[model samples]
Target: MSSSASTTSTRTARPVHTTPIQQPPSDSTSRIPVTPAVLRSIFASSRTPHEERSISRIAFFRFAGFLLSCVGISLAASRGRGIKTGAALLGVV
Candidate 1:
């Protein structure tokens, strides 16, 4: 009984005696935080002027395709076709 009581007391006291590890506060400006200017600078340096124009052209076509798809789907739906069927025709479903 005395050994068991001593073991229990040692186990409880060990955790109470130990201090929690802590980290020091970090500096607010230590990191180069990403902003819009930082993003533009990164892109500007990574791509040539021609490559940038090609990328913009691809993006424009993608946007135009999306608009065309919306128009097609609306026209189909207005023509008494099910919206799901129209979307399926556009491979959207």
Candidate 2:
């Protein structure tokens, strides 16, 4: 019996050369200090009238939801016992 074998050759990869990136110089004088007054001015000056109204409306709705949750919790507690017990729990009684 006769057997046949095949031979294969592999090539090694070469490393690529790249140039280093250059960054712009930063000036300390150009940077602004974040004080409370600067932040307040930034936030106060950037808001439009519509944005102000939207913010107020959102605050009102959040307060209303909080009140509604309190009432619902009181009602659920009272349902298990009595209205006086629920009011006592909420410090109203």
Candidate 3:
């Protein structure tokens, strides 16, 4: 009985402090938007290198070009003499 009575129970936990804390780099970069308005905003963002220009910018440029072409063609056609110009002027053709 003498040897068994001398011992006392104790508890221990596993070491949990080995992980080092790390801080992320500062947020100094501009973010890109992912919306329909992004197409419009992109032009105002920067004068980028030609090779790095985005596809959305190309699409917007193409659409503007197409609209201008239509306007020019309509103007030219509207100037035709007599029947053709009359049809255009009346908004019937």
Candidate 4:
């Protein structure tokens, strides 16, 4: 009879649904400890051409750095290497 009583009765008359909610499938991707092989695969699958080119460039630089490090290490570990090679490896040449 009162407004508050009528509102309460109306709220109580509504039924609650019991259906379970569905979830999407999980598909994860991560970019860490990036290597040339990984970069190449990522670049191939990428939709944007510009980003792929940038990734390729980064891979090139990464490979170049690895080669340079190998050369320096080889020169350092060789028994008969001169002081000039050592100085060069140490960036004082």
Candidate 5:
């Protein structure tokens, strides 16, 4: 019983050793270079209700202009018949 007790005491007294995990060095080539303009575009503040509404309005207008341009180009290329086909293709896309 004393031998078992001594073994238990020695086991409890021993300090545990551990090595900290090391992180891999980051490669410069893997990182994308972000310009201030790109950062501003990505993280633009739209906290206010007015700013949110304005941003939404701007997006809508931009999309409408793009659609109109596509339709205009399609109509010019194929002369009116292509509008339906183009619209169908756009819908599919």
Candidate 6:
């Protein structure tokens, strides 16, 4: 009886206490951090000139193809627009 009661007390025991987190007091006099300038400097350090443009070209073309697919699907879904498919088939020949 005593062993079972002790086992149940151990299972239900409250956790050991721990110290609370400590931090510096807030200071209104501290200069507000400038995020944009820091971020700009970080990006500026990694920048390359024409290589960015070349990447932009590839991304633009990939996006253009994605846009064209939506247009093709829209055209195919319209009965009158289905004529574009016949035009495409003709172009292949």
Rank the candidate models, highest lDDT first.
2, 1, 4, 5, 6, 3
Highest TM-score model number: 1
lDDT of 3 by residue, 1-93 (tens): 466566787889877888887765566465454687786567546655663466658888999999999999987876666677687879999
Tell me, by lDDT, which candidate is best: 2
Evaluation by TM-score, superior candidate among 1 and 5 = 1
Model 2: which ten-residue window has the lowest total lDDT?
16-25
Per-candidate TM equals: 0.46, 0.42, 0.34, 0.38, 0.37, 0.38
lDDT of 3 at 15: 78
Query: How well is each residue in 1-93 modelled by candidate 1, as lDDT tens digits?
Result: 455444444444456557777875598777688899899889978999999889889999999999999999878766897677777989986
List, residue by residue over 1-93, the lDDT tens digit for candidate 2. Answer: 887877878889875757666764587787688899898778868899899788879989999999999999977877899878767889996
Better of 1 and 2 by TM-score: 1
Please identify model 6 stretches exceeding 4 Å from their true place.
1-45, 80-93
lDDT of 6: 0.74
lDDT of 4 by residue, 36-59 (tens): 988778758855788778877998
Candidate 4: list runs displaced more than 4 Å.
1-43, 79-93
**Which digits, one per residue and each the tens of the lDDT, describe model 6 over residues 1-93?**
455544444456675767777775678577566698897667656868676677669989999999999998877676664677767878953
Any idea how many clashes model 1 has?
0
Worst 10-residue lDDT window, candidate 6: 1-10
Give the TM-score comparing model 4 with the true structure, all chains together: 0.38
The global C-alpha lDDT for each of the candidates, from Candidate 1 onward, is: 0.82, 0.84, 0.73, 0.76, 0.75, 0.74
